[model samples]
Target: MYSDDELRPVSALQHFMFCPRRAALIYLEGLWSENRFTAEGRLLHRRVHDARRGEKRPGVRVARGLEIRSYRHGLVGKADVVEFHSSSPGQSPQVTIVEYKRGRPKPALDEPFHVQLCAQALCLEEMLGRGVSDGAIFFGRANRRVEVPLDTALREKTLAAIAALHELIGAGRTPAARYQARCRRCSLLHLCLPKALRPRATAARYLALATQPPAPDDA
Candidate 1:
């Protein structure tokens, strides 16, 4: 188990899952930049994190910008929202997390979303000593929340991501930039320079270079 000081931000898991090198660029190197997508996302979270904003309704209570941590997983961060729902007067309230996103959900990148929410649920379970069975992601574009179950598979993925994140941080070295289609949307694209950092050689060039004889030895 990690101490309080050793805990990493839960949000970094999304970065690592999206791109290891990108995560390194941000956390390991302390690099950051603002793009349209990032700006929008920041604003969305800002609205959700309003300190004075909260809600109480019949059999339910809502907290915004609730700080959460999991020493077991070495993760810590502020949740967008957490709802406590009680079915009966004498029953314990069910804990559920709700995360907000600026963009609509994409099928291709769904696992990372699940992993992030699961991490939050894991933190709540440890902090509250109550089971957090599920959560939801509020998509700004769609204007809806897509509920997610904290199933075994998702928990496994979340744990895996947490482990990999710790491993990356422990290594203390930024990974090489890798150009990909998704890099276009990343806020760190300019700083990351994945395209420029990529090797300027093709498979044929590598084959030709490999077949070349060694130059004459200079004593």
Candidate 2:
């Protein structure tokens, strides 16, 4: 278990991992400016989170907006949906966390979503005293659910990411922009102008005349 002073929210780890500046701005400075993407996600979550009044069907119960907290990791979260599995009405409950995302499944990275879901699992496991072996990510764009296993590998990665996040926050450093194509759509593009800062923009004319191959050596 971790002390409250030593723990950071799981969502912060994802933001810090993706872009430190953005994380710092949001967490430390309390700055937020939502665009179309963020607005859409909020609307989607509102629908599910608002429907959390517990509905029962056979041996399963669907719960929404389940409050969750992990003291060991220093995170507070809410599951958009939780499916409680029971063999009988009197049996102990097993929890399965489901998170809602506004985009389709990611291409090469699951770290961000996994960390968030893992944190919820940790909270549920602590509160319920049962192992959480798996969870799901529901993508809004694709209307699909992705099952993620809580294997040793994912657990280790999630913990490691938490540790790294603490170190980064402690150091108070923001990484320089790498200026990839992804920057174009970033909400912070106006704040992070890689194109304007590029050396090519300042030296384009000088290089053009110098690289004319020296007029065939003027023999």
Error of 2 at 19 (Å): 2.3
Model 2 C-alpha lDDT per residue in residues 28-114, reported as the tens digit of each score: 656565667777888998999987479887877998988877776666667888898886567777768899989999857656888
- Candidate 2 segments exceeding 4 Å error: 1-7, 88-91, 194-219
Pairs that clash in candidate 1: none
Candidate 1 per-residue C-alpha lDDT over 1-219 given as tens digits, one digit per residue, 9 for 90 to 100: 999878999999888999999888888899887767777889999988985667887877899999999999999999999998877778788888999999998878877777888999999999989898979999998898899989998899889899999999999999887788998677776566666566885667555544554322200
lDDT of 2 at 88: 57
Alpha-carbon local distance difference test for all models: 0.85, 0.73
- Top candidate, metric lDDT: 1
TM-score of each: 0.88, 0.79
Summed over model 2, clashes come to 0
**Per-residue lDDT of 62 in model 2:** 95
Q: Pick the candidate with the highest TM-score.
A: 1
